[model samples]
Target: MSFLFLAVIFTIFTIFTYFKRVFQYWNKKQLPNLQPQIPFGNCPNFAKGKENLGVELAHLYAQIKKEGWKHSGIYIFAFPTYMPVHLDNIKNVVENDFEHFCDRMVGGNPKTEPLHAHLLNLKGTQWRDMRTKLRPSFTAGKTKMMFDIIKQCQDCLVKKVENLGSVEVVELCKNFTTDVIGSCAFGLDCKSMENEISPFKIYGRRALPTTTLSRLKLTFFSNFPRLGSFLNIRTIDKDVHDFFMNLAHEVIEYREKNGNTRHDFIQSLIEIKKSGSLTVEDIAAQTFVFFLAGFETSALLMTWTLYELAKNLEIQERLRDEICDVLEKFDGKISYQSLQEMKYFDQVMNETMRKFPPVPFVNRVCTKDYKMPNEDTIIEKGTAVVIPILGIHRDADYYPDPEKFDPGRFSEENKKKMHSCAYIPFGKGPRSCIGMRLGLLQAKVGLCGLVRNFRFTLNEKTPDVMGLNPGSLFSSPVEEIWLNVEKCL
Candidate 1:
């Protein structure tokens, strides 16, 4: 044989041998796992949008649970991923043994991408410090302070809905949330509902990796962080980054020069900056993440809640009655206190989140070696752990008749009976969503405004059985949820 041909044969044999050993990692550790395909492993082709990451994880979860395993392992490409199945195991990973798995598996070079320094992507002490500084901003008192701003945005939504008669609720919800976050986070009047092409709305869409190429880049960057950093890869688009950074600077400059102090998040961030612990970039990064997380997740929650209410008219009417009764108690005004008084409304929102969690999976990277609770298996340091939030929420064992949209599942009595970790729509533990209270408040205000003023029914355009969007990361519907709205008599 020629020398070149011999070299090619050797390379092929070596590559095959390497992958063969790589695929046996889970089995060698004595963990149950599904057979993984070469190159893609057990994960779907996210680049081609073949399946959603959440759906794939949920399916893997179902398979493992069916086999009666407490925990199992899978692969994201050649990388072995640990998945905790039982509620106890999940609690240990997220709460009890949190120190061993404190950092998320998020990939980004903060030095290269300054915005990546935000709380969601930061690790260890950075995250702890940032969380401490931002905690007061999301406290009940602070959230209440921003209530009027949110209500003002809701008024815009109600007016827009009244004029439209029929609407794609997902888009409408996104617009409303965009305005709320814009006003609260950046201290800017977004007016997303009034504008045909709001800049915030436009850039917000660009921020997410919705397109095929962007998703591929995200997958590659996350899977190979060292190499991505070496190449100076940035997941955020340059233009989008510039827009937000410039906007942040503008807001800070205007506020400082005019001696203006607002009751919103940016003002809180400014206080941190004055202490010399934060910079303009730091402020921008935080507010950007605040906008991204606040708007998208809250919008999805509102969208799903409205869709469910539209589908179940009886439940819808009951929730509407609760809203009316609560507002009447508060002298016909929707206050933060009034929203808290709407018990049925809270139940309905909880049920909606259980059925369709905004972010279906929570990821944590093992920072230290840890043994599984009550098991012989040891998760080595640097292992990736995935807590399947969707899987847990929809488990028949935890919630009987998982497919049903019954708000009663979240009643005070029923919730007490459930495992604390079983229904974590916003996740659990210290690393859980920091802005959860604010996000919930945002959704509640928008939902209450709609449910009180308008009656919704599923339009012919909406699919009878909603399917998750494979192209998007969040648990969004495959198609826009169109609703027919009529003014409540």
Candidate 2:
């Protein structure tokens, strides 16, 4: 019995020693890295749900930059990750030497979760090909095609706000976006704005990785992919997968059987699929990403924009005046043309995105060994690279008084002086968000309609300095952004 106990102790010790030695990668390479603990690395607070990941990541960037390092390394759960503090290096990795670092390093197992094989999770030539096929679906013309659908949703939002004198903007925006993405992406009327408990919203909450268990599963898959594969871990919940799969199959069959057509994202995919190349899973995956990316991020954008404008009444009124003037020019109608003329509104949206970008950081993997410019160090293949978007946006050198909620910083003349890659709210280069134009259009339309019809003010329930929710993958308000709303006279 004593010998058996000693053997068990030895096995545990050997495992610990292996991981500790693996953690010495940066040390052996003579690279500066943040001190890492046994398991959580530099993300102890994040893993423990005590701090927001975006804010923590920004703090890490600030720490490395303050130390006068162009680039630094850190461990993310025993994984050696590189953080680039300089935009030049960021540009080099993202664009100039794109071939050396292309894939995002995110894990996706088509066998376990076929819907996870969307444009975002795809890598190499598959991603390139998928991106090429989907490009035409999001063009300026295609966005115009869906503007009327968005406008209808905006009308619903206006009615909903009129009925609810005071409400939490996040939930309202979520409902609006649910309807918009439902119609535009999948050609279904979700009716979330009218119905308080829509299936899409209910299933969305269950499927979204916002809960503790879901996030842990996501982290497990991301950090230890081999183990995840062995267990057949799926990114999406099984019930949610079944729900989407059935709905997608139903929609495709109905369209094919009736020969009916609609100018929506799914229709564009159907056209592509008719070419006999893409499969049903491919169609479902792309549409799911469209809904996921479209609904939440755009909702967050509108939420933050309204929150900022509510706090800054002068900016709010100015924007309202501009929105009103533009609509009057188009005969008091919200159209694609009228929305374009609201330039200051656009500036406000840009600033909102800068301060609270939907995606806090963009990641890339070194696909080939590449030497750092003007340095002896070489970033070996398989190294993870992080471009800290939030950190760069808040940098004093880039945007003075970065936290002051200033929209003029995005003015045409002011923007001219900034670095090209410095303000990447939607990221930069070839791998930038394919749905940017659509996102902007939806956000602008929603905000314009809201501002033109109603007034929003911060309610007493709102905290003075609300921190972001640590659980949210996106930088979202920790609590409900309660606001008093009144119809504009």
Candidate 3:
């Protein structure tokens, strides 16, 4: 009698879940799309982590675009979601109608997920206030103040590359950027350039290790957030959570008690703490995010940039010349002012970001009911809106010869000819990355330092095309980016 009752309950529950999810999409009469399965929706491939979201979404976009649909429907497990494919609609979702669609569709309860308060997870008023306060901290003055830190680390990097001589430095560029961010962001001077177990490197690895177990769990929860929520699924590991929380607390406390102040990110957080308006958990959460954001995202950007440069020698030599000319004015030191003088450096960075945005994909939530531009269709409230940044960036309509690595595509004149919203590696509208200025500063400083000193070539082992690590949220290499570098001077 007990076993029979349990089976009956399971059958009823399964039927209800199917009705709410699987059958709902069928009744909606939504835009045409690939058929969804009972549980995974149109993302069985994504659920298996078999392909990257960017590539997967781009493939979907291509198919929908071919169908002549400017906008299409997708399912995050039978929850009808909006995917903007046309230029006008995508622009409206991000820019013109931003107020109606301001929040990125990231979900986390603040009390349960304290670390989620970090800028990436923050929304609306909280995001605005924190962003305003933090914006000035990344100004040219702040970036310049951190110049010595990057140079010191870059010197370490160059020496490490010099030691490698003719041999390949697998994942060399990523480590170089890691060292740069460590010194600049955390006040931790690390030789990730040479040392495998540098504390900063170890901590970064711990922050997002991309284990098989973690990936599977994340896919399940992200696809079925409501179900996962009810089941008490937690993506952040207890050990990782504790390590970051304790480290952040200790760092902040030591700096406050010792009467120490450096113009780095931690120092800024220290000021926020001293203000007494915010809690210690708030400070620790932001610091943890700063460290993670500073290292992984910027490292991947630099790695992709270096790999592209390796394959394009003419462009590489041109950029190296620009670096030389700019540094010559600053007595051969790469200063903030000197870096700014290299307009070509800005072009190269911009083009690199276009080809390989750190966050290749992003989501926005529709705040109010909104109409798809030029179409009669309305996007109902509570729909998850996905913007395929990587797809639009690589589209041949926007970029001529889309596969070509051409920094000249971003020259001032060429930029003037392009649409204002065409390039969005830092994203767009009011809710874009608050840390954009600092993120760009760190990436440019490291790239400039590398271009000024080393001549890099594609190693025999360099992947034909950069591959994404399946388990990461950010675009990361599945394998290390190997390169052969020689001292230029």
> For every model shown, what is its TM-score relative to the native structure?
0.96, 0.96, 0.90
Best by lDDT: 1
| Ten contiguous residues minimizing lDDT sum, candidate 1 | 43-52
lDDT of 3 by residue, 1-489 (tens): 999999999998987687456546524645666666656666666667776777677777777888887777877555667888887787898889987787765444445668667766677888777777677666777767777777776677666666664433335656876776666656666678668877667767766637767666665554555676677766676666776677677777777789877867777767766777567788667776777666777777777888888899888999999888878888888777787788988888888888888888888878789876666667776677888888878888899887788889998889998876678877788777766766777778777777777888888877677767666767777676677777886
Better of 1 and 2 by lDDT: 1
Encode model 2's per-residue lDDT on 190-257: one tens digit a residue: 99987877888787667678888888887777666678889988778889988887888889989999
Per-candidate count of clashing residue pairs (backbone under 3 Å): 0, 0, 0
Candidate 2's displacement at residue 342, Å, is: 0.7
> For model 1, how does the per-residue alpha-carbon lDDT over 125-218 read when each residue is reduced to its tens digit?
9999999999988999999999999999999989889866789999999999999999999998988988968888899889988887777677
lDDT of 1 at 390: 91
Ranking by lDDT: 1, 2, 3
Off by over 4 Å in 1: 1-16, 45-48
Candidate 2, lDDT over the whole model:
0.86
Question: Local distance difference test, per candidate?
Answer: 0.89, 0.86, 0.73
